[model samples]
Target: MIVLSEESQRTSGKDAQNMNITAGKAVAESVRTTLGPKGMDKMLVDSGGSVVVTNDGVTILKEMDIDHPAANMIVEVSETQEDEVGDGTTSAVVVAGELLDQAEELLDQDIHATTLAQGYRQAAEKAKEILEEDAIEVTEDDRETLVEIAQTAMTGKGAENSKDLLADLVVDAVLAVKDEDGIDTENVSVEKVVGSSIDQSELVEGVIVDKERVDENMPYAVEDANVALFDGAIEVKETEIDAEVNVTDPDQLQQFLDQEEEQLREMVDHLVDIGADVVFVGDGIDDMAQHYLAQEGILAVRRAKSDDLKRLARATGGRVVSNLEDIESDDLGFAGSVAQKDVGGDERIFVEDVEEAKSVTLILRGGTEHVVDEIERAIDDSLGVVRTTLLDGQVLPGGGAPEAELALQLRDFADSVGGREQLAVEAFADALEVIPRTLAENAGLDPIDSLVDLRSRHDGGEFGAGLDAYTGDVIDMEAEGVVEPLRVKTQAIESATEAAVMILRIDDVIAAGDLKGGGSDDDGDEPAGGPGGAGGMGGMGGMGGMGGAM
Candidate 1:
């Protein structure tokens, strides 16, 4: 009966369940208002006074610094959604919260937790099926629809005003990186530059090296350039063991300096002989080597990031030479031009105008740093959704159209099971409506009126009809150019359900006991720090400690 320690604390049975459910619901409510295009933003200020203004569910949850375990689980739902498809994070967290609320109602009706979990699993599987059935066919050739998908992903975010430009850039980036294995969004990089407007953003045909030429005396620009990439440094070797030069005479010092100058000259002559006009090195450039390369009229950029070098190789069709001795003619990649330009008051070398580039970069320009940072987040989300759409080859109308359709279909499917489990399945169907309802509420429309109109449209067999957050009219989402990837909806349902079921099954929470010190005396009497000293049996009410209504 005294299995736990004295300082331990515990909540059990109905109290534990209610406590967990409330914590999950609280997390859901925190981000509820950040649900749609019209949804408000969350301004998070951390303990250090650093601020983040984003409606992005994962970002908000990450910055919230939540303490409760169950609330953290709900945050994981958003994180999972973002990792899987990069969109629908808000919808996933909201759906999970609503699922917890619905399960709480069933707990009041004496339904066992296992039964609710089983029914939820069944409902989640059917929901994915409904989403697949509702999916509209889309291909890479459907540029218009793909752009719409990107636009929908950035609709209410900071990039909405420039969504058209951003979406087009995103779709183009995805398409450029598409291969037989599908599109890898990692091949595209977004570089933000302040002091420019949004519309001035351009898609660079090659990677943008955030470094400048190693020496200012070298050429600032080169056209029709032959590029060389190195994975090692272009500096003189230092002795591994400690060695001292006995420079008792001036001739010995001159001999040492001449030897170093000769070594640097050889390296520069080697590059000039290779006809390499632009060079990127993975390590530092020695000052003497810099003088030599500058004299040779070669542009050498040192301390380049390894990832940028890889990307540069891919774009320029060049191989990264490991050493100067291993250099060959084929190791040099070709670029139309290599130039150093001042962007946002910082000098950056551009390896661009590549032919048939497999890796690309986006130069995102904004009037300010914060504006560009938020724009970068929006562009990243847009790129992910577009890539998901192309990979799945299917999309669904956005603006809660998919949720409304799935809710109706799930209800009819729930009726086919006719048992206590059926009630849970129906509850799931109702929870799915939270998407459209939240969308309505965020847009300041009457939730009841919007829900009614939406259900009537679905009931009348119009599967595409959904609430227009802009006009409060129930119109066809497909016609309104609102769309998202099929993966977004299915992934959200799966993640939300798993999180809800997991939280619902926890009926006990035992916090760790305090580690108390002090030992008993030599007698066989009660210990010095005995049960009465802290929380032995007192913590559990002597085995009858299901406090409150158990």
Candidate 2:
């Protein structure tokens, strides 16, 4: 059992919130270096001692079993990115972290937390603008680049030879779906089913065929056929009430048996008028219905499961099932003839109705089940990414590119908004500085020196003043308009700063008892038979500051 006191409640809440924010920022920063082309790698070890090395932000966050609420929120950011864009999860997180780091300075200078949050939002708006300015329209030549980009993104996402094969597949799929307006990703969809192999591979316009023959003598295909796959039994057979009872004495049972024969005959006559060329039954058919189907030239199949009936409905684009009593045009799907043949050590079924085919099955071959699974995953991710990109347009750089530029632009904008708010605005600019600083750190360079270099090289004037350790020469970044990938670095900066400021702003922690007491009319009251309340709820008396260092 657990008991909470007012003081303890107050202490724990603040400490926990702060711990979460601080630890989360650190985690975000750790992954920042892995952004962009020059990004570094992270080697992670799981509880089972399994090892993984990758710079992928989503993978990194998921693998690291962090226990901070604030940090988890950052993870949620990546999840959102993945769900919404199919990519750039790392970018969003990194930007949020950097924004948080920037906010921390303002917090230190006594700027309100709410004010810092507002400033960060403004800065984000500016950064988005920079991204828009950098956007370029994709063209014919750019398709290969885009393919390479898509392929690169898909690598290790699980396809073998994804570098070439996956890229080609995407291009082919896109071309197949393209119209005057461009690729129609929404209309071109794919579904996979697991079954024994078929012929090598082929495309058909209509859906594939899958229905068993009801009668052994029924023809495989009906030319220009309209098919109906039904759920109800077609047999005229009925189990009559006159069937003999199991009770002892054979004489009493013999009298009841005579009535059953009469009822079975009437059932047979009713089925003949339904006009069913073939009647598929979901269960065993009675002998009477079987005999009627044979005499009336009606094909009868029995023992189909309800699931198979539903599949048949979808396959033929038919309507729902009706009772055996009412069968009409509205309740039936089209009927067709299908041919099955052995090809390449597998059974292949072909259905050719009048006009063109609407569906095709692509037989993807793989050496092992795992390999196939991976390939399928890659295909799915690739398809999803393509669809998302087509819907949303191109992605911004993964490392802090446009965002760093945007930060600088916002700083200039802040200079004009003079007042106490300007101080907050400057603090906001300082918070934004973390993006570039983080980018520099991840690049294995000095943050202070990088900032100096960035400023000196800012043209509209002169250049060159930094020492290169290799050549002992001066280097300039501004003249080149050089900025690292904004996505990765900005994510780190925003996540870190947001986390840090959130930790610092926490002033109170309330416990169950505290809430209970606060809710009561009395100003104070001691709980009966409970453990003594400790003002230091987190058990860290005077150690509250440690929360910010997480």
Q: Using Cα atoms with residue i matched to residue i, what is each candidate's TM-score against the true structure? A: 0.91, 0.54
Q: Which ten residues in a row are the worst by lDDT in model 1?
A: 541-550
- Summarize candidate 1's per-residue lDDT along 292-386 as a digit string, tens digits: 88988899999898898888988899998889867777899999989998878888888888886788999899888878888888888898899
**Per-residue lDDT of model 2, residues 37-127, tens digit only:** 3456556665466666556677667766543445566777776555544455555566555555555455556676666655555555554
Cα lDDT of model 1 overall? 0.83
**Model 2 TM-score?**
0.54
Runs in model 2 deviating more than 4 A are: 1-9, 12-17, 26-67, 138-149, 155-161, 171-381, 393-400, 417-550
lDDT of each: 0.83, 0.47
Best by lDDT: 1
Identify the leading candidate in terms of TM-score.
Answer: 1
Q: How much does candidate 1 score in TM-score?
A: 0.91
